[model samples]
Target: MGHTLSSLYPVHRRAPVYRPKAFVVDDLATLHADIRSGGLATLVSVTGSGLVATHLPLLLRESDGPFGTLLGHISLANTQWKETDSGIEALAIFTGPETYVTPNWYAAKQETGRVVPTWNYAAIHAWGRPVFFQDADRLRDLVTQLTDKFEAGFPAPWRVADAPENYIESQLKAIVGFEMRITRIEGKRKFNQNRSAEDRQGVIRGLRELGAQGDTRKTEVADLMENIESEPPAGY
Candidate 1:
């Protein structure tokens, strides 16, 4: 293999290992959109013992603030919410499509053997103070909204009202509702934006092949990369 004229200079610099903004997504709509699509989130907070985390599905209220509010309910038996302090901060992490890319997927690898394997992923972090409440009426409303949102895609969507009123009320009594008024948020969408067009195309092709082998991760990432590539160049 021989070097080309384009190889005389560095075409792309490696991104920082920590919080590189090459694909940092700051659009408020996009951030909330990802959260909606990926309903499950890991909520983390500092407890008296140390740090504790609970995984739950969160509903986003966009009009609540500049960031937004995360709503969810947990079992009353689970004292994690009770241990949460109003003065302390908490974090909620939501993740979307992610896949591993091999160095062989980059054209630059064949040219200079300089490329290395890396992971591409999309994620969002929401930080706030946890507010817990047990009002029966509010809990019913929150549970109904959560059920409606999740069931909307089903052909025969189920509703909270579908169950017996007494049963639904009893269920709500066993749980506690909480909301996190987001004070800060960070969204990252690292999908080879730092790579050259040639390398990116190579990644897209390789991902497609893996997708054909029945890998959902590969399919999702490939679709996202193709969408970015198909978009008009910035500042048209």
Candidate 2:
């Protein structure tokens, strides 16, 4: 896949000041790998008159060339694909665990009651052109890869081919395979990078005490924070 500014830049819109994020990812391969390992993402598309969104597992196929293709499928009964206008773009959003930060989580808040609640999270948005296909062979390949990835933990791993031939064929007919040539990718690691070191530590401790998905993500955020602290300042 070829890397170009036109393909990797985010579509900017002026609105919520809170929506602006630091665009940190500069490597396509690293960004693609993150999305691939994250496994699931929300695919959003706009039709002529409406919007359709579906949560699904996606596979990223790497190419030696400039761009990679995203592989996934949607139910045949879902008319969203057909409703979308030709050349319409789509967004696949992958969100990691996120947590709301209460003012109480900040040590600075104890001294000054000016703090407001915020959220800490990690997410990536991938934009691409959708390519839908109904070919039986392609469908089979997609199903096989999806099943294998999800079933690898089982004692007797499930295999699509293990099912009766007719059953498998019938099942494959019920879905449409699609490949998206990713044209843009934007990654945001909103883990309180804007906060002071002490305040970030306080947030991490608060999240850990909460012991939820957000807390689990805090562990990762903590690691990132450590790495940032250890690195030499840029242009030093």
Q: TM-scores for all candidates?
A: 0.88, 0.80
> After superposition, which runs of candidate 2 have C-alpha atoms over 4 Å from their true positions?
1-23, 212-236
Candidate 2 at residue 32, lDDT? 74
Best by TM-score: 1
- Per-residue lDDT of candidate 2, residues 1-236 (tens digit): 87433334333521111334342544676567667668678888766556689889988887822657788999999887677544556888887656678888887887777788887766778777788889999999999999998888899998997999999999889999889887766666666666677787888777666656555666665565555456544301
Candidate 1 ranges beyond 4 A from true positions: 1-17, 230-236
Question: C-alpha displacement of 233 in model 2, angstroms?
Answer: 6.8
Write down the TM-score for model 2: 0.80
Evaluate model 1: give its TM-score.
0.88
lDDT of all the models against the reference?
A: 0.84, 0.72
